[model samples]
Target: MRVLLVEDDQFHASYMEDVLAETLPEVTEIFHAMNGEEAEHEARALTIDAVVMDLRMSRRNGIDAARTLWMERPETRILFWSNYADEAYLRGIATIVPEDSAYGYLLKTAPRDRLKLALRAVLVEGQIMVDREIHRLQRRAASPRNTLDDSEFAVLLDLAIGLQDRIIAERRGMSLRTVQNRLLSLYEKLGVDDEASDAMPLNKRVRALNRALVTRTLNIETLETAQRDFDRWQSTRKRA
Candidate 1:
């Protein structure tokens, strides 16, 4: 297996190269690039089996680079490494690529073992492995009470994860003003009037989104039926 690694930080780039070498001895060659521009250049120049990319970079971010690579070479696999598990990031990438292709997303803080598992899954099984936090963020973004449109929800998830408006706007293909307007509308709907107010901190909004997601997941009708079943089961056990 040949891999292309795209990361700006020297320490992280070196550490990942070491990890990949140690973990996958079968990997014959590993190519390195400091940014997305270099990554695209190298990717087009060679035939690589997979790419390990960092989403946040100085120029031509991972998503754009990945899109270019995927379009140019559909057979090559992509695995994203990001510090944040923002919903906008996930959805943005999803919109660009089909689900069946070999892809994965890992948080920068992911455990080594988990990272290994994700790589193996993508390389061998062609399965996408999302970091646990990312999975949680996705579920939260699908919540009902958020009352946000798909785009707005995506941006809100990014905001909740501490992404700046500019990054969110770029990822979502919206202008900065549009991003701000959507955020304002979302906050209003959530009854949050003041940006400076503590009533709607990022973490708090994330928690609410999570709760709403859980509630939606357990569909009210299903919850009622489950409750009834539990009540009956308890009564029967008591009688026995």
Candidate 2:
């Protein structure tokens, strides 16, 4: 079986290469990509049957790359070996994978045997494999459809980084009223009942955004993605 190993860390990739080579003798060809951008290109160019990819990368994130890849090739098996099993990652992956296709989400901290098992399960048996913690998080939390949607998460990102509704509207190419509507949805989904919280003097938006941050959902990676988007938006505005 041919597999693509997508990771930004060279050492980690090399080590993983060794592990895969030793454990999975059926894996004949193993290609490597340092980031999601390269991974995307490789996926299109090569005869890859499966992929072991990282979630967070500098150029493009694994979720976006996986989405693109699956858009083109839905049957290709994916094994997400990530440093974080963040809810964002979970939500993102949930939207992309084919309704019937099997996949895996094993943590970076997992044992070597666990990684081997995930690799085999995803690539060979075509079964779902999530880390214990990720499974616990998934079970403890609401289903992806029940949680925040992408539009609401986009609004949350703006609020997480202190963006006003007017600015978020402009950045997202939506009307201010539409942005406000999304915020209302976000508040309800996040359960940021500022009205009930007597201690929080701030408005619902501030409280809701803060709740996301405190829960470690809206983290630096989220902010960085938003910042990169802002930079692109600013550049486009300047040009226009």
Quote the lDDT for 163 in model 2: 84
User: Which lDDT tens digits does candidate 1 get at residues 1-240?
Assistant: 889999999988988898888778768999999898899999889888999999878767787788789888877778898886765466557766754678889997888888888878776567877788788765675555555577776665566545678867866689999998887767655544433356545544554345433433222222233344345555875798
Residue 168, candidate 1: Cα error in Å is 17
Model 1 ranges with Cα > 4 A deviation: 137-143, 147-240
Which segments of model 2 are wrong by more than 4 Å?
137-191, 194-200, 219-240
Clashing pairs in model 1, backbone N/Cα/C closer than 3 A = none
RMSD from true fold, candidate 2? 4.6
- Model 1, residue 174: distance off in Å is 16
How close to the true structure is residue 109 of candidate 2, measured as C-alpha lDDT?
85
**Clash count, one per candidate:** 0, 0
lDDT for model 1: 0.72
Best by TM-score: 2
